[model samples]
Target: MARTVVPYSSLVANGSLAQPAGTTIDQSNGMYIAAARPELTILRVANTNGTDRVVTIKAGDNPPALAGGQGDLAVTVAATSGVQFIGPFESGRFIQADGTIEIDFAASFAGTITAFRVPRGT
Candidate 1:
């Protein structure tokens, strides 16, 4: 059986600004939830440091679940670089009770992560 999802305000928006002495996006083991039951439209992780950065993003709030031979799901960004994952919002892809998104990175590097999502169900 398929569950029906309620429609929310498509104009709802949320994000965070991480900067030097701003928001430490390092080994603090931080987690951010965009919205409750969100349909993600855009997700971005930007490296604003002067060196390479190792960033890890996990779906949901669990530690990690690797299906393939691939090791820790991570991305390496060069100095002063960024990466964005953008596409049409899907119900199952970004849906979470609070749209939980986890991000971890090396201590030496600095960066900012943000996501744009619309929570399903009013």
Candidate 2:
């Protein structure tokens, strides 16, 4: 899977992402954020698969390696559905210092996740 620093406006703007389209993630490939870590307020996860999928999030810049059950919080998205984790969250809740904020999957599936932050640009 490919992951990069996408614009925080990607959620509000009605347009395509400057980054590449999202791919499948599972035991083999998982989403990783390492380039730039800024405090994010919104997290949108869209699952395009035929079956339901679970999205796992670990917040930190130097978090432990993925070994299943590494999620600080996990949310399940129904098949072909989407959900947004909105936040003007408590301090340290939505912030990622470096690349420590990791978003992963429990099973291989097709989906896209975009994060939005205030005064964007990292």
User: For each candidate, what TM-score against the reference?
Assistant: 0.49, 0.55
Q: Please, what are the lDDT tens digits per residue for candidate 2 over residues 1-122?
A: 45433334444344444643543344345655443343444566778778787876655432222232332666787787665453433224423555335566766656676655544443
Q: What is the number of backbone collisions in each predicted candidate, taken in the order shown?
A: 0, 2
- Candidate 1 lDDT at 122 equals 50
Mark the 10 consecutive residues where model 2 has the least summed lDDT: 62-71
User: lDDT of all the models against the reference?
Assistant: 0.47, 0.52
Those runs of model 2 whose alpha carbons end farther than 4 Å from true positions after fitting are 1-27, 35-38, 59-71, 86-98, 120-122
lDDT of model number 2: 0.52
Q: Per-residue lDDT of 1-122 in model 1, one digit per residue for the tens?
A: 22212122233436443422223354554444444433434445567888787765544422222222232346687778665443333334333334544455677766665554444455
* Candidate number with greatest TM-score: 2
